[model samples]
Target: MSTETLIEPPLQDADALIADMGGRARAAAKIMATAPTAKKAEGLRAAAAQLRGQADAILDANARDMTAGEANGLTSAMLDRLRLDAGRLGGIADAVEAIAALPDPVGAEVDRAERPNGLVLRRVRVPLGVIGIIYESRPNVTADAAALGLMSGNAVILRGGSEAVRSNRAIHAALAAGLSEAGLPAEAVQLVPTQDRAAVGALLRAQGLVDIIIPRGGKGLVARVQDEARVPVLAHLDGICHTYIDAAADPDTAVALAVNAKMRRTGICGATETILIDRAYAAPRAIVDALVAAGCEVRGDTDIAALSPHVTPASATDWDCEYLDAIVSIAAVDGVAGALAHIDAHSSRHTDAIVTEDAAAADRFLAEVDSAIVMHNASTQFADGGEFGLGAEIGIATGRLHARGPVALEGLTTYKWLVHGTGQTRP
Candidate 1:
């Protein structure tokens, strides 16, 4: 659509293509599991360099994607996720280089013990084998998931959304070429070429071929994966995150935190969807005014609606919505108790935060809120794997299992028992 020649995927049948990818990834994962740390780093660094070198090509591909996306009527939030500029492309490369610098978690010792019979036993981290990362939009995930999987000694199979198909292919081409040039296995990173839906089903059912399936997308994609996949899944559901401004909150700080948490980047998962202002807060009206003034459409409860004529009366569903847009839902609560009650009922257990100078209240909220990532006096926008310094994230795992919160390198690995013994047997 942008007059850039679109790169087509391999024209194999969906099931056969996915099967081939799974098998290739499994073979590559076996080799990668024991690869020296330097080699993995080499592969990542090469990929980063390629990302920068091929910037023009990738941008052209993304331009085509943008035109198609607009024609297809994709949401503004999704288009934002799909759009790629030079700066964002460079950021992706930088994240890859940062990942390359990370200490290889593979083969790192987790714990050690010695038996009375002098049998030394230790547990060490290992790859999760082949990682099937199925993500929607955000073409940068094509690079992040590949870099992370390779860094953690697992072969990666990427299946990105149809909306950003060209963008994903362009980025993956750079990665594959770079990794191959670095002498990594050719199959180290495989991109499912087709945009067919059947490929998703195949990947979901490839239990043995794919060690783990991480679905990073909307509710429909995640729900389908969770329900149909026979393989283990790392689910990242809706980011129904909340930010509560306590009665003891500093007025200026509350305004700043609330603004940044919601309006900084409305499309991000970290953006606060619900803002709970304590009725006794020094200036609750100021916070509402700030959000409204920032071009944000504020949906408010009855009290908040009275404070600003611009405020739309919030519906009951507004509290539970993840409005990945310039819209926000605001409500005034009695205190921390009421704030906590609302969050407890509506939170998707992704991330929640409290803003208060009262250390006692902060401590209580920090300890009491049962979400995966909880913060005190900080913006929920900080809920990112890159911000958390793990390089980049596959996704925030809301499900309480193998990992939780911005999942990164450490989360990508599992542990295995290693025994160093002198022929000690059961006596």
Candidate 2:
């Protein structure tokens, strides 16, 4: 569908291409690590200007992907993620500029101390050498990852889904032009120029060349990466996000949060998949009614099924489903304790929220839940990097070891101990 000839190579060539790219990325990472903040900001700002200035070309490329997706009977949600227009393009550019404007995290001193032996110790932030990003459907990620990687001083290799290859390439070209104009190494941000899936395997196994791998997509792709990757992976298993309506919750607030949290953007990972309502709430049915009116299909337990005829009886597996659609499962709980029990059993530990006026209940819920993101009296949809005051997200890490939720510029970096001392004799 692209106007230019797409050069898809053979499967055997994937290993060589990935290896070559990895070597270049490793080399670029060194240069990017020490690049001045002003230079990085200049390159990203130029890229933003280029993206907005060349909207027509980007939109045309997106049109090609949309047409092909429609012909292939792709679902509407899938098409929506792949399709882009002038507005979305402008938004992407704005995100890039926002990232540029944030304070640079590299070399910022986190802690300092003086030891008894006349030694000074300082811990300073440093870039994670090279990162590989594998994502699906969202062309915006190409720009987000590039901007964050450049600002955080890391070299990145991006591989978007096959469905959006044309759009991704077009976006990558604009970003590259800006980097070239600012004298930044274009290799600092590279897109896999092929559609062969074997390339993914090669990237996963690129152990020494890549420092880490972050996969953002459906469960199948993430599972494959976690299972096969030799490089350490930062990924989320599922966004089976939850919202609990406490017995002391204000009825109006509960209803509003539920509708917005689930139906605001049903296809996003932050969208709520299941809801738990306290049985003692005065108007339990009002929440269900509002959700159904907002075009969401409500599947509820027997207690909730009694609230409305429109409700469907939920089965056992609905407890752990990530619908990513207008479908939600609901259950009636005794109190905050019941809500926590339910969440503990079926949660993916990505995000959980509680809508309650009772401070004690909110505090308990917030402290006990072991999710990456926890909210009180707010929508689960706020689990995003930009909303958290970070410019843009590299990914939402549900893994515990390296980075946690809404990874941004700071999370893309590691730390090193800088030691300063006068000449001293060893004991």
TM-score of each: 0.97, 0.97
Quote the positional error of residue 78 for candidate 2 in Å.
Answer: 2.1
Model 2 lowest lDDT segment of ten:
1-10
Which tens-of-lDDT digit does each residue in 242-265 have in candidate 1?
999998898889999999999898
Highest-scoring model, lDDT: 2
Candidate lDDT values, in order: 0.91, 0.93
Give candidate 2's whole-model lDDT. Answer: 0.93
Pull out the clashing pairs in model 1: none
Cα deviation of 320 in candidate 2 (Å)?
0.7
